[model samples]
Target: MKICVFGTGAIGSHLAGRLAKGGAELSVIARGSQLAAIREKGITVRAPDGELHCMPRAAADPAELGPQDAVLVTTKQTALPSVAGTIAPLLGPDTSVAFVVNGIPWWYYDSEGGPNQGTRLPQVDPGDAMRKAVGIERTLGGVVWSACTVTEPGVVEVRSPTSRLILGEPDGTVSARAQAIADILKAGGLGAKAVPDIRTELWAKLIGNLSQGPLCVLSRQDMKTTLADPAVREAALRSLNESIAIAAGLGIKLEINAEDRFARSVNTAHKPSILQDLEAGRPMEVAAIFDLPLLLARQAGVETPTLDLCVALARQTAAAAGLYQA
Candidate 1:
């Protein structure tokens, strides 16, 4: 398979390395110092399974890589506009674009049948740019569970012992393309799969983000460190319960225990990605990760007082940093 990974940051570089190791004809669209490093030394991932190093064609422009069978977009939500602007060159008629991202994706409503079924989230997409650029028919929703960070320009340090990437089509059908991507990733030693319900998977991952992300961002600490305080852990429980209620109201039942999930993270040293963005002074994902859920809660008529408070504070944090507006 000919694959291209756009925005080869921490997660992108790790996936690129895995795809290369899995025997795909891989290329990466990257920029700046990271691009230089990948072009020089390839991508090296220090994972729990083992150390993996694979070199792929690296370029700053999608046009240089040409069309690919699949394109994995792994940048933050804030970069979607620029990605849409440059993504056309790497898309072919049969290309599948998988957004391996966090939070509610821009294409969440494309084939989703419900009360809010064709509704557009301008907060996430902003003028339907991604819908136009990538086309909804070829879009695949994905969620990843990996604590990966770029220790160096081309080297990624994956702190998580287990990493998984889940992909599915918008209409909840099993897609061959998604399965193919999952197979290659699984072959490369990551837990990857294509499921019938990607939304459920998304919300399952989102509950953790809602429970831990804001608190970690505010405390400037890792998950284990921030949740160490009994009071903060209590607040996280409230947040998780509220998020579950919101998901339930949207007709997606997630069977997860809040305390159980929180307990599992008590010793984790991984900092939430939003905290990392805050520390890096890059644009934070306040809209997609924080704001959109609140909006959906209101739409679903779900009362999320705990989520509201935390998301508001987190939004202010981003605003104060000059990384987010509104």
Candidate 2:
């Protein structure tokens, strides 16, 4: 299968290396120094067990790569507007686009069957931009569990021993291509699965994100340092609980306990992506990652006092620094 990884940053580069290891025909859309490094020395994945080096077809322009069997988008949520039109060149008739980033996705409501069934999240996909270009029928849901950092251009360092990925169709149906993509990742020594209920898995992953993302942004520290103080731990727990309540109110059952999830993330020394964006002085994901979830809480009649306060403060801090827009 010809697979393209859009925005080949830390997670994207790691994922691209896995696909390249599986010996699939792969291409990557990267820019600047990262693109130069990939062209010179191939994309590198540094893992706990072993290091992987795979030279993929890299390009700055999506049209240069053309259509693909599948596309995995791993950039920051706010970067979507800049690359909105550029993504079209990667679409084929049956191509699937998998967004492997955090927070409520653009296609979140496509298969949502409840009180808010088929209700679109304008905050995530404002003005129908994503839906117009990449229709909901061709979209896939992705959830990834990996701790990674880009130490340098084209170099991805994996901090953990195990990383997992889950893929599913928007409507929760099993797809042959989803399983095939999962098989490819498994072959490359990653835990990849095709699931029937991607929403549950999304909320499970999101609970961790909800606790760490805003705290890290506020503390200006990685996961370990920010969750160090007993007081901070309590705050993280409160945020997690509120997120879990919101998810349950949306009719998604999160199998894991919110506190357990927060505790599990306490040891990771990696900086949350939101923190990374803040330090990099890039556009931060305020709406999709933080706001839209709270927006859903309001829509679902869920009271999220803790989450509301923290996320608002974090957004204001980012906005004050001009790293995020309202």
Candidate 3:
């Protein structure tokens, strides 16, 4: 199958290398130094398993790559508007567009069914650009468990011992298209699955982001270091409980033990991606990873006091740095 990976950052580059190694006809939409490096040296991923190197077709314009069987959008939420404007050239009649992003997706309410069905997240989508560009019929929900970073242009370092990608249809059906993409990712040595409940997977990952991301940004330290403080650890536990409560209010009860989760996170040395962006002076995912969850909590009438405080401070930090406006 032919696949195109949009936004060849850390996660995108890692997935692109896997797709190339998996023997799919692969291509990438990239820009700046990363694009030049990929065109010159392909993509190099230093993973815990081993080093992988592959050169897929690299282009700055989506039109240059044409339509594909599938397109995985690995860009941050901040870039989605621009992607929507340019992504049309890469979609075919039956092509699937999987948004393998963090936090709550913009398509969270589409096909969700019920009173909240069709609700729009203007913060994430901004004028329904993505909804119009990639219709729900061709959209897939994806969640990835990979702690990675691009050490240099076209080269990524995977810090996690294991990485996995989960894909599913928004309407909760196991479709052939989602399975095909999962198979390609698995063939490249990454653990990939096509599940029936992608939203559950999303909330599970999001709970971790909520508990760790804001604190890491405030402390300016990695998870292991920041979470080592007992006081902060307790706060994190409260945040975790509140996040789970928010999810439960949304009708998705996540079976996560706060202590057990922190026990594992306290050993992780990698910094959260939002912290990385703040340090690099790039735009952080304040709205998607932090703000949106709080918004959902308010909508569900779930109180998230600990999360509210941490997120407020983190948002201020981002805004003060001129990275985030609100």
Candidate 4:
């Protein structure tokens, strides 16, 4: 299979390296120093399991690489508008566009069968740009669980010992396309699975971000450090419960223990990506990761006092730092 990873940052670089190692014909859309490094030295992934180096085709322009069997969009939500502008060149009639990023996806309501079905989240998509560009039929949802960082340009460091990527179709079908992408990721040594109910997986992954992301951004610390305080940990629990409640209001039941999940991340040194963006002076992902969840909670009539406060403070911090507009 041929794959083009759009936005080869930390996670995307690691994934593209793995796919190349797994024997798929791979290419990447990249820019700036990272693109130059990948063109000169290829992409490198440093993980506990091993290290990998591979030179798939690298280009800043999507048209330089052409269409592929799949296009994995791993760019942050802040970059989605630009992605919408450039991604058209990377699609064929049968290309699968999997958004392997964080927080609630813009395609969340596309396949949901109910009153909320076909709803567009302007916070995430901003005037149906992605919906109009990618369309519903070729779209897929992806949730990934690897803690990764760019050690340098063209280099990705995988901090987690265990990593997994879950993919699913919008309509809850057991899709051959999802399975095929999962197979490539699994072959590259990540635990990959295709699920029928991806919204549940989305809620499950989202709980962790809701629990820690805003807190970390506020504290300017990693998960292990920021979650060290008893008060902080308790607040994290409240945030998780509220988010879980929001998911329940939306009819997605997540069966994870809130406290246990908090406990598990107490020793993780990974800084939330939103915090990374804030510290780097780049645009923070407040809209998708923090704001959208709160919006959905309001829509569901779920009360999230703790989330509301943290997100407000986090948004303020981002604005004061000049990294976030709203």
Candidate 5:
């Protein structure tokens, strides 16, 4: 399989390396210092246990890489618009694009039902650049739980104990293409699963993102350090409860209760991607992780006072840093 990882930063570097290890024809779309470093050192992945190195074709522009069978986008949500114009060179008639990032996806409502079906969220998708460039027909649902960071340009470190990727189709069916992608990832020692009902799976992961992303952003600390304070813990639980309510209103099921979810977060010492972005002065994913849910809550007629408070401040933080967009 010819797979190209667009926005090959921390998560992209790790995934691109794994795909190379799995013997796929892997390429990376990168720019700036990271691109130059990869051109010199190839793609390097330093996990907690070991390192994997591969010299995939690296290019600053998508035209150089041409078309591919699959394109995995690992960039943060806020960077999506900035890169959408450059994404087309990696697409073909049968190319599958999987968004393996965090929070609500730009194409979330593509196959969703109910009153909000086919809705366009300005905060997440903004001007609908991604929706226009990568249409829902070739779009696949993807969720990745690999904790990774680019320690430096062209250097990636896997931060978590286990790395996994979950994939599904928009209409809730596990297609042959999805299974093929999963098998490739698993071959690289990354656990990968193709499941039905991707929307529910997305919501399940989102519950955690909505709960901890903002607190970590505001506290300027990782989940463990932030949740250590009793007040922070209460606020975390409140945000989580409100997310549960919003998901329920949207008819998405929750496997575990909110309390257990918050406890699980409290045990994690990792800083969310949003916090990482803020500390690095990168754009924040305020819309996907927080703002869009608030929109959903309002549409559902759900009360989310505490959620509203955090969302407001989070938006301001993104704006103050010049990361939040209209």
Candidate 6:
């Protein structure tokens, strides 16, 4: 398979390395120092299983890479609008575009089949740019459980002991294309699975994000440190329960133990990405990660009191730092 990973950040670089290791024809769309380094030294991933290094074609423009069997978009939500505008060159008639991103994705409602079916999240998609650029037929939903960081240009450090990528079609069917990608990722030593219900998988991962992200942002600490306090741990558990309630109200019953989830979070020393964005002066994903979930909660008639307070404070912090507005 010829694969192009758009945005060679931490997750993108890791996926690109895996694809190259799996014997796929790989290329990456990157920029700045990262692009230069990938072009010069390839990509180095320090993972738990072992070290991986692979050199693939690297460029700043999508046109340089041309079309591919698949294009994995791993950029932050803030960059999606730009991606929509510039990604035409990477799409062929049969090409698949998987948005391996965080928070509620823009394609969440395309074939959802519910009260929210066909509803568009303008905050995430912004004028249906992605909907038009990458049609639903070519779209795949992705959720990743990799805690990664770009330690240096072209180098990524995977902090989690286990990393997995879950891919699925939007309309809740097992797809051959998604399975093919997952197989390649698995062949490269990363855990990958193609699921029937991507939304349930998304919410399963999102439960952890909801429990840790906002609190860590407000406390300015990593998950372990932020959740170390007994009181805060309890609050985190409450937040997790509330998030599960929201998911339940949306008709997805997540089989998660709030205590177990919070316990795992207390052991995770890595900082959530939203906090990382705030410290680096990048735009925090307030709208998608924090705000949209709350919107869904309201729509589902689920009250997220802890999330409400923590997200409000975190939003203010981001706004005060000029990283977010509204």
lDDT of each: 0.91, 0.87, 0.93, 0.90, 0.85, 0.91
TM-score list, all predictions: 0.99, 0.97, 0.99, 0.98, 0.95, 0.99
What TM-score does prediction 1 earn?
0.99
Tell me which of candidates 4 and 5 scores higher on lDDT: 4
> Model 2: per-residue lDDT, tens digit, 161-218?
8998899988889899899889999988889999998888898888778767998899
Candidates sorted by lDDT, descending order? 3, 6, 1, 4, 2, 5
lDDT at residue 156 of model 3 (Cα atoms): 100
Error of 3 at 207 (Å): 0.6
Candidate 4 lDDT over residue span 53-132, tens digit each? 99989999999988899999999988998999889988998999999988888999987996899888888898889888
Model 5 residue 33 lDDT score: 93
List per-candidate RMSD values in Å. Answer: 0.8, 1.2, 0.8, 0.9, 1.5, 0.8
Candidate 1: worst-modelled 10 consecutive residues by lDDT: 257-266
For model 5, the local distance difference test gives 0.85
Per-residue C-alpha lDDT of model 1 across residues 221-290, encoded as one tens digit per residue: 9999998999988898888889888889889989888778778877888999899999999999988888
lDDT of 6 by residue, 39-140 (tens): 899999999999999999988888988989999999999999999999999999899999999999999988999988999899999999999999899999
For candidate 2, give the lDDT. 0.87
Model 5 ranges with Cα > 4 A deviation: none
Count of clashes, each model: 0, 0, 0, 0, 0, 0
Q: Top lDDT: which candidate number?
A: 3
